[model samples]
Target chain A: MTISVLVVDDSPIARKMIRKALPADWDISIQEAGDGDEALAIYRSGGIDVIFLDLTMPRMDGFTLLEKLQQDDLNCFVIVVSADVQPGARERAMKLGAIEFVPKPIDPQALREVLREYGVMV
Target chain B: MSELLLNDDQTAALQEIANIGMGQAGNSLARIWGEFVALSVPRIATVAAARLPELIQRCVGDGRVSAARLLFHGAMRGEALVVISAADRRTLGSLMGFPAPAGDGDPGAQLLHIAETLAGACLGGIARQFEATIGFGAPALIGEDLPARAVVRADTLGVDLALCLEVRFRVEARSLAAHLVMLMPRQEVQGLAVLLDRFLCTL
Candidate 1:
């Protein structure tokens, strides 16, 4: 079984890091977006099961995207992976419907735990 | 110093690192001011003492501006400068608990305190990400509504070309805004590149 993942961030390096962090054993198909607008488009195109999002981006940031998703009742699970590690940030993301808030340069072990907790990986 | 250069990956990594740091800084500012803070994606480049010209242009271009500069040492060594316009300086001054009409208090001291809070949160956030500890020197008010180039203390400027990271923090729905400029000397650039590479490899 394969899970479709979308990694959204303005920094290519961040996207690369997220790609590297995903479990190697999981049958995951990954898509990348540079900002929220692009991620929304990709999600609308279907086949996305999970999203790793960054909050700060050039056009349409993660918070606004969350509002859009909530308004439309988008069903995909979103995990905010950002460098903005502030209590307020976590509160805001969770309030906006993010299932988890992972700090930037996410730890592989912690990421695995989240994936497993969500049953995205065994 | 021969011009220090960063490869594309190194540059991209630095930008992301700066973004994370600045986002946290913005959060700190917003909390204190009781407002939302907007952050610019950090711009990175290797600059010389010439950084002052651009900084002067940015802060003073709008109007009379003030600046406070601080030094940070330990795993990373460099200067952190906070530049704000006169109007924003007044706003930040009031936010820092300086009671009175913003104009009545010492704008210089106010800029220094604001700089400490801003530079501390910003550089502290970056240091944490680098897994390094950094210490700050007392921030000095380098200039206040001063004439061209005076805002930049020419004598205190470092001789080496610097890896300069620039980020802007603007308070939403208010005129309060600041520029946080961090200058990492060329001597530290190689070490920084190693650290960036280490981060890349660990991923």
Candidate 2:
């Protein structure tokens, strides 16, 4: 089965960085969303297997998206990729049902490890 | 700033949080400029709201500065002000693909855009740490003048504690020093200080 991933962030540069950091070896279909609203639309189409989410955005934020995901019981692994590295941020993202939290500027090694831990990569 | 409001532990905790926030802010700039951005160790200060203007002057010194002032609202409410000297403003403008002096349109507007971008980057990073969302008001440009003077003219929000930091940002051969001043109500700051201490204790 081909894995599908969604990279959601307001910054085009950041979204591109996230996409670049993905494991190049995987059979992955990557997607992009600039905000939570767009992300929701993409997510509802049901091809995404993993989501890389960002917290701060203009039209609907990651938090609200997480809430909606929980309410709707969407079964997809979520990894928050954001610049908000404050202590509580990680905790909040975890509490909101994210499987993992990655602080940004997209560390490729970190991304690999997270993907491996979740068995998204062998 | 009569009494030292934050104790040693609290001060250290706040400093750590500020460092994380600044680091994220630096990363944001690095992406924008496509160069490594150097962020200095931030010096955090807790001052009375009434004394904030005085404190700004002391740090800003005699030179006129262009400040971008954006008010933030969330679990805490206040303002985030980024101040840069006029000399640095021209340098940064040119770096951002604008002509030096950025004269195509209102120079103040151009500077204000930079200010808002930088300030948003910094505060957005900080707010994530608190697990809170901070909404920024439309950014207003405070032209070449003392930050305090511009803030006084533009804002009427009652601020009680100002968390001030002197952060130096460098990109390649060019460097710009700017101030990130977060104005919070006394009660809100105290609450944050307490929260920081608790977070540290857990660590």
Least accurate 10 contiguous residues by lDDT in model 2 chain B? B146-155
Candidate 2's DockQ: 0.04
lDDT of 2 at B179: 66
Taking the tens digit of each residue's C-alpha lDDT, what string does model 1 give over B1-203?
43656778888988987787787788787777777776777888776666656655664464677788999988778889888876677676557676665445766777777788888888887778789889999999877775535666545665646777888887767867788888877777788788888877865
lDDT for each residue of candidate 2 in A1-122, tens digit (9 for 90 to 100)? 78998999766546766777887788888899988999999999887899999876666878889999998797899999876654455677799999998876568899999999989888
Q: After superposition, how far is residue B202 of candidate 1 from its true place, in Å?
A: 2.0
- Candidate 2 — what's its lDDT? 0.70
Tell me the DockQ of each model, to 2 decimals. 0.53, 0.04
Task: Give the range of the ten consecutive residues with the poorest summed lDDT in model 1 chain B.
Answer: B146-155
Q: What's the lDDT for residue A37 in model 2?
A: 92
| lDDT, residue B36, candidate 1 | 72
Candidate with the greatest TM-score versus the true structure: 1
Per-candidate clashes come to: 0, 1
